[model samples]
Target: MQKCGLTEKSPGQYVDTIATDAYVWYEENWQHDEYDHSHQRYQLTYVEEGYQYFHIEKKIYLVPQNHVIWIPTGKEHRTTSEAKTVNLMLVLFKSVSELEFYQNVHVFSAPAVLKEMLRYASKWNKVLTEDTEQQIFLQAIQNSLPHFCKESSGLQIPVPTDSRLIPICSYINANYQYHFDSDVLADKAKMSIRSLQRIFKQETGITLQKYMQLIRILKSIELIDTQQFTLSEIAFKVGYQSLPAFTSSYYAIMKTKPKLKR
Candidate 1:
């Protein structure tokens, strides 16, 4: 595995092939380039910090901090980072039970114990020397897999396919600080207000306003984790007129108070 800083121009990347029965473990602390690729072995990717986006089958899914994304074999996907520095753990191994829990791409929350196990597994990037140790690590991870399936948190929002609605989603993501109304969003999508609402729901299975709120809360969480901005600043930055409203919405979605760590 190579260790380097990733930039917008040149992002760091690593790929390992599962020749026989092998499990590859590595951690990447940099942004990744966007490209469509596939591997023969099952992949379990955990985001330790920062955010990552995956574009699969024309839909984009946001993988936030402390989240895990499971990609099955032969699934062509493109990945990119939403932040400048993204710390990610990549585990590639063969598992017959890959489709037992999830058939398509899935994301779940990574509990503290699983996080430590992944960190421990990151040491075996090149090869596992001891068969007994490898079995122990594999058993530990498999035992914890059922818990992950039960505690799966679907934190992803699928990008719409309608060309008209694409700009509206992009506008909200880029200018999330601005107060938006359905009229403005309808105008951007070049549709009537009712049409906009109906189509957004049909395409994304979420109301426009609710989707915007989800975006705001997720963005605020990212900002809060950075510890670079105060809660008030983050509130305003994500388009809340007041801190109370921001806090209320944060609690509604995240079930916790928004705090900025110094």
Candidate 2:
């Protein structure tokens, strides 16, 4: 292993100077609400245990355990982990060969191989010298990232920024577990239902109904992660009156059935 050269520089300064290829770290019992910031390096954050909510631009992604969030270089974002105990493996690459996958932010399912590679890479948590084994190994991980990242988890919610739509969105987010008609949202926004639907689609790129469904599904993922509720209970908790309705909507978003974390 290459010896770590610890420096007194700030986090940004250290990453900018020391990371020639990749900088890696494994954080246990990690919980933080980070400020909005951008990085020069492409970042991969793997959630080994708890979950994190990543706000990238207008979208909020729920990155649950056994999953990874990839943020391209210079993407403005912030992350909040409300879970009391979390394990995260974070890797920042100066650059990678896969430009397509590195162009946008995505959440992908982390396979066992990738997780094991991350565990091995965690040991080399500092700046790596060129031509060293550590650098080569880290490079391999960077190369494999794009391949494994193709399977997206589809756990994101797009938010609207329009002032007229803000309250409606807040209402839906807060009451995602209850069924409400579009009229309620229209009343909240002080707009006609037709106008509300149009502006919501224009700003969020999805219909108001779809957005509400997305919120419900997002909340369901959180509830599922807790391992405290049965699927039926979670379905009802997230506003679905029946299990089949919940399963159908969940499949539409996640492309898979909800897995109980037993």
Task: Write model 2 residue lDDT over 1-262, tens digit each, in one string.
Answer: 1112324144323235564677786778875438676657788888988788998898888887889988898887778866656888888777788568778787988888998988888777653555587788888887787778756545777778889888888888899888788888889899899999999989978888888888898888778777788999999999999999999999988777888875
lDDT of 1: 0.71
Q: Which candidate is the best by TM-score?
A: 2
Residue-level lDDT of model 1, residues 1-262, one tens digit each, is 3321111232323343334344645555655447776656566778877778787785666777778887777787778764646788776655545446534677777778888888888777656353667757855675566567533333566688889988998888898878868899998888999999999999988888888888888788778767788888999999998999999998776556777644
The residue ranges of model 1 lying beyond 4 angstroms of the native Cα positions read 1-16, 20-22, 82-84, 128-130, 150-154
Candidate 2: which stretches are off by over 4 Å? 1-20, 126-131, 151-153
Q: Ten consecutive residues with minimal summed lDDT in candidate 1? A: 3-12
Error of 2 at 128 (Å): 5.4
Clash pairs for candidate 1: none
TM-scores of all candidate predictions against the true structure = 0.82, 0.86
